[model samples]
Target: MYINGSWTDAEKKQTMEVINPATNELIQETAKADETDAAKAVAAASTAFPGWKKTTAKERSSFLLRTAAILREQTEELAEILTAEMGKPLKEAKGEIGLGIDYLEWYAEEAKRAYGEIIPASSSSKRLMVLKEPVGVVAAVTPWNFPVAMITRKVAPALAAGCPIIVKPASATPLSAMKIVEAFDKAGLPKGVLNLLIGSASPIVGELMRSPEVRKITFTGSTEVGKKLIEQSAATVKKMSMELGGHAPFIVFEDADIDAAVEGVVNSKFRNAGQTCICTNRIYVQKSIEKTFLEKFTARVKELQIGNGLEDGTDIGPLIDEGAVKKVQEHVADAVQKGGTVMYGGEQASGCTSDKFYTPTVIADAKDSMLISTEETFGPVAPVFTFTTEKEAVERANHSDYGLAAYCFTKDIGRANRVMDGLEYGIIGINDPIPTTAQAPFGGVKESGIGREGGRQGMEEYLEDKFVSIGNIE
Candidate 1:
């Protein structure tokens, strides 16, 4: 646990073990903080809030810039830790580290742009001003899939907005979060300005929920847990932002370039072994090109090299754990029973050292009734479904309760525009699958999530607008 500018343990000296999903090997045991520790961390943040928030945006920006520099200097080391703990390919792990650093650098500049506004007054001698101010202490619960990136996504913006924050990373991947704390410390961020709690989610988040001093909560994970947090936060009425579950729809229009569409799908769905929320959940290929797309897609998917993340030229890595593997198996089994045909890979890979490996799978003739269509598979399984018309493609894509991300591959400018406007998701990728960046808003609509991360809107999530009216102003 990192609290009040120092590294400490739980009050009872409890600890939790972190394991490498690639090999099921124990990495290390970290502090298993409880409600008491949560209270202390929140109290520390509350105490630091007045001083930290009073600092000018430029001063905070400097701290963030320094942290980014430190992270850049240690990118290789941090990426190694991420790969060892999270089981992402070394190349992908480095990319995540780079993206995390990008967040810090982007928000460092954006801090200076948290602009206020002056409103026109109706009466003479009256002035109206709207000021953007920090929303006080904040708490973040991050997911394990992109451990380093998720931490920076929440923490960078909060710190830039001049809010003290407590971050509780998923228990499976706490080391990456801890390294971030170390970077912030090296950069001399003020005590309590940023804190880390490694433990069970219930006790730490429950304590944060009960504390009135903690005014905001930002979470990136499943919708089910997001709902529970919403219920708990009702008592405090804390401002909440959720980046939750996503069953993103990837569409290949009849007019799209077949080669480009195949490449885009591979990058989007197979990257991270299809564990990402925005990874294509249901692939919709126009019936005209369904046969051609599948033939090329299957050939491409077979070329993917699967093994340990640490090994050279490994494109696909093991699933996070045994449970993740089981979920993938279940989804594949259910889809097959419901009439979906396996095109390429389906069962677990034989040569892999661990049983946590599941071969990248491609199943055709997927239907809405199948389990893969409704639930998030969160594995390297591509269930290809076909659509007949533009209307049908749009309808089938928007049928899911989740509206996080949707991708469309179309060469026609007018068709691309139409699909972009028609999709209900918060983020849409036209002819591009990996569309996320530090400068764009990343979030979802409806049950997928609430509020946005990244871009200018991200910094605003940590701020509150205060309206001031002055009368008798000379």
Candidate 2:
């Protein structure tokens, strides 16, 4: 764990083993923190808040810029650590590092643009001003899927907004978060400005919620966990921002280029073995092109080379753990039992290095009633459903409780606009597979999430607006 500008152990001197999902080998042991350690981290952040918040935006941004540079310089090393711990292919791990660097660099410039406003006064001698200030100490809890990227997404904005943050990364992937902290520390971050704790979620989160100094809580995880945190933090009434679970839908219209749609679906679904929150879980294709799309998609899915993340030319790697594999298997089984046909790659891979390996699966003739259709399948399984009309496609896509991301492939301008507007998701991709970027607002609607994570809005989550009215002034 990192706290008070130095590397330190937990109060109880306990440790948790970090395992490589590819081989289930012990990578290293990280400090396991409890409530006592959480309190210390919170105290350190609270103590540093006053001084840190007083610094100019430019001064704070300088540190972020330095950190970004260091991250780029050490990209290979950090990517290796990420792949070893999280089981993403080396190429994808590098991409995650790139995303982390982009967030730091983007937020560094955006910090200088956190502008306040002056409102027109009704009376001659009155003045009204609105100022945006840091929301005090922040507790950021990030998930394991994109460990490094998630940390940067939350921490960069908080730090850029002049708020001190204490991070609790997923227990399964704490080492990547620690590496990021090391970079920021090496870049001359002020003492107590940033902290890290690795442990069970309940106790640490409980400590943070109970602390009066901690005014904001930003989390990236499941909706179930996000709801519990909201309930727990009710007493403190802390400002909360959550990026929760997603059951994204990928739609292919009859008018779309079938080959292009296949490529897009493959890229979106198979990347990171579909562990991403925005990965397409339920695929809805227009009946006219359903056969062609599935044929090409299944072919591409089978061609992907699955192996250890460190190995060259490996397209897919193991899931995060045995539990993730089990969940994927359950979802696939449920879909099949509901009369869905396995188009390709349904069972676990035979020649993989670990038991966590699951074959890229594609289910055809899937219905909305299937488990894969209703739940967020955070795995490499794609359940393809056929729809006769645009109305049916939209209805099936919007049937879920989650509305994080939705994609449509169409050549018709009116159709594209119609589907884009019709979907309830927060983020939409038309003709393009991956829509997330550092400069865009990334979030969801309904049970998917509460707030945005990127773009200018991201920095706002860490700030509070203060309205000042002056009378009898010059």
Over 4 Å off in model 2, which ranges?
A: none
lDDT for 378 (candidate 2) = 89
Worst 10 residues of 2 by lDDT: 392-401
- lDDT of candidate 2 over 221-279, digit per residue (tens): 99999999889888989999989999889999989999999999988999999999999
TM-score of each: 0.99, 0.99
Q: Could you give me the TM-score of model 2 versus the true structure?
A: 0.99
Cα lDDT, all candidates: 0.94, 0.92
